[model samples]
Target: MPRIKTILMAGTALASVLVLTPSPAAAQSTTKPKAEEQQEAETSTAKADRETLLDTITISATMINEAVFDSLSATSYVGDKDLERIQANTPADIFKTTPGVGASMNGDDPATAINIRGLQQYGRVVVTLDGARQDYWRVGHGSGSFYIEPDLLKAVTVIRGPVSNAYGSGGIGGLVAFETKDAGDFLNADEQYAISEKIAYESNGEGFTTSTTAAIRPHQAFDIIGNVNWRDRDAYEDGHGDEVRWTGEEVTSGYGKATFRPAQGHEIKLGAIIQRYEDYVTGSSGSTSATLSRYDADTINNTYTAKYTYFDPDDRLLDYAFTAYHNKTKAEQTQVWPTSSIGNFRYYDVRTTGISGHNSSRFDWMGLAHTLTYGGDYYYLEGESSASHFGQGEAQAYGGFLQWMGHYSSWLELIAAIRYDGYHLDGETKGTTTTPPEDESLDGDQVSPRFTVGVTPFTGFQLFGGYSEGYRAPGLQDVFRGSGAHDTADGYIPNFGLKPEVAKSWEGGVNLKYDGILTESDILRGKFTGFYTKVYDYIETDFTITPRMTDNIGTARLQGVEAELIYDLGWGFINLTGALIDAELIDTDNPKYKGQPLENAPLDKFSATVGFRAFEDQLIFGGQYLAVGEVKRTQRSSGTNPGQVDGPAQYSDAFELVNLFANWIVSENLKIDLAVENLFDVAYTDPQSAWSYTSDVEQGKGRTFKIGVTTRFGG
Candidate 1:
């Protein structure tokens, strides 16, 4: 493709950035430079200082401690301040400002599913919490969803393309990693123990939240931290002043961690987390018409992990890490049907266990610097359903990879990596009508590869590109679960011969930084990316024959452009972000669906924010504007055999929103935050929502007021 050739040429001219320390001689020479040369010299000096600050912030998603601009991938980072500024209680709120990313809320459940570049569901976009994969899902009329509490998160990292094959399998859509706070994040250098308390309230939902955290360093080599949160809320009113039933919920969460250093170069950590949610939902379809049956649901998620690390800068081969973890999630629903004898029942359950380890070595050969990383991982999963009888299956998968990074010169860097994966499944249903499992087996394996090249032509600019491949094995549900119960595709059966999904992707991007561009303290950073991905053997529901099932769609393509900018104007900062995505079913077995736009693919999105600080940087204020273009979709058929619907009449309307927030540090130990969402009370429906197809669509939250207070006891 012409795009690929252009990116290759750019890569050959630019190189990767590895933040380096400023030279003492260069710093001293800045004072002696002439007036005409002084500005350029000072700019160079400031660039080094700013780059050092960025490098200190490590990104856990990539497993490398390099600056964000140094990689040949599209990435973004959100810190604690950003989270608080948005008053984000949901994943949609947290990612509202991010480009090329979309989130869908599962009705009144408060759980969320992620979409990246029009690909999602069935683990396509890998999500992790504290290095442990979150892989629980259920087939429903709405989008498949996952769970995670935001109150415990300290930071979030998002990689928006298949350029991250070395991270894991089935991440063709992208990766989202959440990191929890440690004692070090709360305590000052001289403080050994600390306690923080927080309380918050929101008017629209009549929601109240309380949180407490304690950190203690009992000894020089040992440290521990614990956190607990409780929240209660009532149903919230939408923009039309009508209460959205089943929106009320009660939640409780707990987290604990302990770290110990046994030697000068060895460290170990043990961690555990638990979350419980109690709510009453009026319907199973998550639709306004589902009030015929009410359900009282209890959801629980638990995880535990142990990790060890060893590092010695003097030894080239000693940087290593090992981890073992277990996670379980269960959702039980008690239904109150008008005529049912058994009023209570269990809904769904899933459990997972895994172990992984990796090591890296750095050395110099000839004139090039090389770093080699290799690791292996294995996981076992079991899923069960009580009342619905969706499926009962046991599955496992294992994989390993070897990656090498070489710095050939100051202007060129290269990366090559490959991974091998194998998976096996057992248990299957008897017939299309029956949901009972019978003995059945399936197995498959594949190898995926990645190659990347980065070029840096100057101190503040980088151009990079990469080509990578990704693979996704069919999940147990795709092969073992009988779909007869669903109304969409009647008499749906299971297909044991289903093939694995694969993707070939290409990406090219440029990052520019200018420190002291106009003034000594001014800084500007911008990044732009162009990406294209072609997925083969794409999975979709089939309705061709009597026994409807899942089969491979020939091919689908997704291409997009994303841009982000941040400018520091000495007194405040301005940020701008935008994305344009186009998705199409290029080649399918059914010619009628060819050239159709993929579901949930929004055409254009844009966001802008302006923020400033006052009172010696203790007080901050910000405002944001977000706009989204119309989404093209296939409408549901009115008949029992609703084969396929596509055209211009199936488009959803576009919408825009405005929000404002403020943060004030009253004192060294106390702070307050306030935010107003949907300031104009505009009625809008997210394109990804299940109810967006109807004229009487469910509206989003109206003008809402939120306030929070935090107090520190000791540090």
Candidate 2:
């Protein structure tokens, strides 16, 4: 497809960067045929000035979300001083600093995955925020999205590996982009118009998170920004508060952005986003004990965006962009089933709806730079169950992709991409029949590929490597489930006949930046990486009862190595990270489960930190340790049916946390800050939850403590 003719020649050179920016007032009113050569240029113009800042600092991670770092893959960035000290809801703290990537949630929940070089979620990798294509979580009764609301963010970029045809076929496992917050960056450089606020607290649980931001910018062309976030929670005790694990929750979110440059590298942007949530649960997966089973779950979301860009006034030879988007996700859950004669009670309702549309593009050649992206997606799902034995489902599909990035300058880099997908289904169940639901239509096609290489050879040392191929597509109640007793697969898994799961990966690392590199004066930062991945098919969970879903198991392998070290210590900073993974399950044909050990794969994990600072940068003190090691469910070959064996193989755990924070400027505009989370009193459980063989292990979050304060009004 010549990559769609290289994005149609990058949209005709982005309309020649809008005809050279209106010719700068027609070159100063076409005058000066030599008025004494402008009096010798006014004596060399009182000196000199040469300027270039990549047209106001190259936005969108480099025009249209370019992904080709680490040579076609492995890209990770999380700015804003690490979002002012972690607790970043989703994007798992910036994809764990990228590099062969691997992430886990279920511990504070965020609905995320990217495991490249090790292949995860859908098999290869694909994540997007500004350009759409997101499941956000709802894939198999999980209904995720991690409660999305991180103060409307400002930065987060990830491009792990294997980006199938550039971005298609569920990305086969590579792509992440959540870049928001732009309204001329809230002006105020003597131009006036500004306001900002933040309130936060952490110490295991018991929550209060508040945020506000505003920017108006009278004119340097035009700018407007608004952001808001609020979260409230009560329920703790695994470390304190007595005993309440992961409880009660409420969240409200909103953001608006507008920017118009009229001329000068031209631009136009409009946006809107909203989210509302109410939650309460006591161990999902059909609760048992820990009461509070009076469940509550609701999510409402809306996003609308339109974007355009053009640039090139010597601005790196090229720049181009076009964007359009719409998003909607409505989720609901309420339950209290389990009774017989004594108080007879029953009620279970589940609902989901999604609608999506999106598009993307970018390029710069001759210096060797190319990027081409394409899009198309649609969905409609319906459900209502209370053991009525009825159903309805529909999901349409269309997809396309092409990616190419080659730098050939500044020490090598190369990347390649491919993608194509098609899905369809429509159905009914004869007016809630006693037993008559198994009608369907199916379709499919997939192709994903990737390759990358990044090398610096010297200077702070940089060396990278990558390989890719991935796929995932099997939803809609896992292809028409039916029958009864929680019908899983209910019968026919031929909803267009499943098939689309493949993964192959690789990873190599070496990077040691500099600017402080230890001692040289204090400010230091360090990173270390190691990886391994092997897999095939691997998509378990099945019981064929009627529609009891989850399939594609047979082969699997996952190896791991992780490390991290950092020190900013201008006054205080310290961090250390570690991980180890070794998974199994191969050629499972089921027979009680071939070779087991794949329930939530975890071998070892660790985290440590130390911090202190006073006055100067304000007060802050910290100590933390999160640990996990030894876990087994054994009997692999594509697990799930391991039963009888005396249960539990091994489990080791640890958690020690102590924290306190304060920031008191108290002058030149006043400021205040405070924080404390799980200062000790540990009780943890987040090995990525298999729910402990279905549903049981819930204990986590205790010693609760949280407080936040902020003040600022107009400026």
Candidate 3:
């Protein structure tokens, strides 16, 4: 295992160093050259675009806008061009090359759960779309899951670790924000109206997709955009030519937005999104046992948002934004198998309403530049389920935060922030044949703090370190929903004493940026981070005691190193990303469980991409290589359950994958894309998947080819 980690890190470093070495053309110039000379020598527009992207400003990390290359925390930004380059089909595809991030979903379902570092589930990782939070969960094999249409996204921003606690409460793990396309993204500078249509096909699942977008700028003060998409797919075969059951699905989604500028310094925007999914799933949705059930399922997700912002170029005292949003997710299922359970119907529904506002003030104080920001947010959530043991409750959470950023001269920077979070939960425990239902309630509050400092001793280089704290309140289900045979020997017991989880993290990293490093028209940029996090009062299920129920487990420790590097020359570019992590639970009462690797932890992985631009940067081609490490599960005896030892420890073998993608701009109004996924067609299963059973492993798709065409018309 140590050798593997060494190899992964060494390979990434070697590749980057080799790419940074000067070429024959660059070596011919012995003296320093002018910036204009370098710009004039650039022939590929893609190179310039890449440099600009590296400077893209992001607001997810510290709530203060700054470029990803300069942010003190680990941050990543994915723009529309990056999405198009990868030909993303699902949300997981968008982060395939990002370090310290993992996404898992069942082959038969479209819902996805994201993991950051070794933490997941129950608000650990905050996910939002257009400022509306997505907090839907069920007692299933996987953790909390969310549904979204990737085709509707214009950009995505991710901040890893609790350093982003100021973004919202319960984001002890991190934050993932998705921004949808607007009218300005579709309409041309001189056009009053525009329309775009796209069609795509995939060979593996025999999938088909059609999307249409229309935008209208009726006047200088107002604009609107609308989009609709439909997709369908059949079950695809695995690498071994075997059909994976219940993999087919049909989906329909729509998005619309309107923007108005009421005055010179005031703007208002409203947006809505809706998605529907239909599919067949086979499994015990609430259990991890091998026994399964079959069902026909239909799901719908909807979100609505309104935002107002006021910013005046002449006023340095105030920059304000206020937003309100609502989201709802509902899933209906009907049983199909087992004569006794036939005709049974189940449903799960969740609704969330929230409002948030913030303002920033900039000024010069005592020979230093300073920015002060303050914000507050509140959300109300309600969930109802037809199933006996599923979540059925209501929860409300709110928080207020203040942050300050200061700069001294050109080399020293400092940031400090603090937040107060509170939550209230209420629900009723299900009644059995011999017992009546009972109402339950719980409440908690806490305060967290963060501080950071950065130094630049030389040009194009920076060193930064920080310490941050985050808090996560217990979920409604964690305090309610106890059900069983009504006997202490065979049922679940509610633990009203369950405590919230708190995370304290320490991180240090370095940032590197250089223009004209190896060539007059070349650029190199990179970020490397090392983080250690200790979670107190970690929550988990305690099966060792009778009447199994959730409880606050012992402390957990997780540490990892992540690296991302990008090198772009005139004609081509290279990207490398990798992460190695170690995680374990400590001070557990159960001796057998102590020091064991977390079941939800992801394996070490590395990715590399190399691409070339031709025909005046109108055509692009690229290929990606991915390698994932193996995972081993240790065996443990099932306490109190005699004659039934827990299933043998399972081993998930390591795997390798290859992919190729290409895009062509045949004309200003037409574009084409082609790609091949799983190029090697190796039979393998992702180690991060939660659906794997002792006897069955969910296999990934086999070799597949995809093609897409898009056209635009405007007037």
Which number leads on lDDT? Answer: 3
Instruction: By lDDT, rank the candidates, best first.
Output: 3, 1, 2
The sequence of per-residue lDDT tens digits that candidate 1 reaches over residues 164-213 is: 65566677788888778877777776788989899999998898999899
* Number of the predicted model whose TM-score against the real structure is largest: 3
Clashes of 3: 0
User: TM-scores of the models, in the given order?
Assistant: 0.90, 0.29, 0.94
TM-score of 1: 0.90
lDDT of each: 0.74, 0.50, 0.82
Better of 1 and 2 by lDDT: 1
Candidate 2 segments exceeding 4 Å error: 1-123, 127-170, 173-177, 184-192, 203-216, 220-684, 689-699, 703-712
50-79, model 2: which lDDT tens digit per residue? Answer: 011001222221124431222223345565
lDDT of 2 at 155: 61
Candidate 2 TM-score, C-alpha based: 0.29
